[model samples]
Target: MSGNSAERAGELEVVLVKAGRTKIRYRSELLLDDGNHVAVRAPWAGEGVRDFGFVRFEPGDVFTEHYWRDRWYAVKEVRAGDGTLKGWYCDVTRPAVRDGAELVVEDLDLDLWRSADGTEVLRLDEDEFAESGLAERDPEGATAAVAALDELEKQARAEGGLTALLA
Candidate 1:
């Protein structure tokens, strides 16, 4: 559970869904699956370097992603090919669902980013979240998404930050 030495259960197809459509689907090495929480390792799924000023996700970046079946968020720890810690990327989403070899998660358009040194903790896509009209369409879901984002941001700012949570 702490390392990648755990039994490898082949691969899992991670499906990111938004607005009732699949936004991205990538295969990841299933590292840990404890019924409630699941962890996987995968390379950057983006085509090229996606520089966002704060961070860049390139082809050689590796992502150790964690998803919870009960939590409304997913946390991904990004590292370079040489094993340099980049940071953590969190997605506010509905609880993940596992069906056979597929893991499905619905994005709520809210995300959080934390720098490796913990100097930068950014709450992103609030405007997109608001403009998504999820509040009007699904009030409960919207509320949950907002709450999840807040929780993640708070955790990312804490003393040990996401490191403690992920550990």
Candidate 2:
């Protein structure tokens, strides 16, 4: 989290938090950090193939993730090891916080996914979001999370979809 440009290129520890606890954390190569937006690249952190029926995340898959301090979501561009485009996996979360070498993001439990071909745009994990009782506990955060999910879905269905947002 240095202001110096030359110090930007290095390893960044990504901490994903859920329910006031750390969910998952991994190291990623910090590609860009322009104050508001932070981008990092990392290989799939899961141990085995995760088949979601729509997409499979296995070894040799890379994820280029984008997080914003001013936004309530994070977008991840998934690609195969051979450089084939897969799709985008987006998470509805609280605005990201950069603490020294650690980038912390809180999972709001809502998610959206868009296929690379733009043939399928899915809203995922709404049940989990509701079950989390965010609305009862934190109404404002719950509202923001829903709004973020809506905005992401709209962008995913737009003409350029996620490509336009990533670009």
Off by over 4 Å in 1: 1-9
TM-score of candidate 2 on Cα atoms, chains taken together: 0.94
lDDT of 2 by residue, 1-167 (tens): 45333246587889999999999998898998899999999999988899999999999999999999989999999999999999999999999999878899999999999999999999999999999999999999999999999999999999989767656
Summed over model 1, clashes come to: 0
What is the C-alpha lDDT profile of model 1 across 40-124, one tens digit per residue? 9999998899999999999999999999999999999999999999999999999999887788999999999999999999999
Q: Estimated TM-score per prediction?
A: 0.93, 0.94
lDDT, model 1, position 3:
23
Off by over 4 Å in 2: 1-9
* Alpha-carbon lDDT, every model: 0.92, 0.92
Give the local distance difference test score of model 1: 0.92
